[model samples]
Target: MWTEVNNSLHRKFEFKDFSEAFAFMTRVAMIAEKMDHHPRWTNVSNGHQMFLQTVACKNSIQFINRVFAHSNQ
Candidate 1:
């Protein structure tokens, strides 16, 4: 679930591996370019796991849906 903090949206996303994380980030860049809107983001990884931080309601929602569809496979 996404939460609001200090006027910014926040969420915790988990990925199975580094490749999945990188792929999602790449897709986000593409989406942001096409939409002409970008979110502030942060990415952290530990070995094969990934955690992402993003804010921008519309962009975040769209990204989550698209990435969830393609992740872990």
Candidate 2:
């Protein structure tokens, strides 16, 4: 699940290993490319964290949907 924090949607995922975590991140990158948007992310051990902030002059609902959709996947 994701929550609003500091103006960004934040989520964390845990995987079986570093490779699994990396694979998830890769999927996220591909999705983000397709959406023409990107999120801020980090990897630590077998965990991955991501955040996407609402941009000025953009559709916040769309951004939120994209962020959470990909973040959950």
Candidate 3:
């Protein structure tokens, strides 16, 4: 789930490996680019931590969830 903090949405995701985590971030970037909304994040090993400013747009949160939900697949 996404946590709201500092007027932004924050979430940390873990993947099977670094490659998996990197792939997920790549996918998110493509989607975000289409909407002109980008996320700020950190990646370390299998962990991916991301934050999206609420000011971006309401759909950002929804879009993030959709991507996150399917990331495991």
Q: Which tens-of-lDDT digit does each residue in 1-73 have in candidate 2?
A: 7777676777888999999999988888888788767778999989988877656535243455554565566
lDDT of each: 0.53, 0.75, 0.72
Poorest 10 consecutive residues by lDDT, candidate 3 = 64-73
- How much lDDT does candidate 1 score? 0.53
Between candidates 2 and 3, name the one with more favorable TM-score. Answer: 2
Off by over 4 Å in 2: 56-71
How good is model 1 by TM-score?
0.58
**Top candidate (TM-score):** 2
Residue pairs with backbone overlap in model 1: none
Lowest lDDT sum, 10 consecutive residues, model 2, at: 57-66
Give the TM-score of each candidate.
0.58, 0.78, 0.73
RMSD of each: 6.6, 2.9, 4.2
lDDT score, candidate 2, position 58 = 56
Segments of candidate 3 deviating more than 4 angstroms: 54-73
True-vs-predicted CA distance for residue 60, candidate 3, Å: 12
lDDT of 1 by residue, 6-36 (tens): 4444555677877877777788677656656
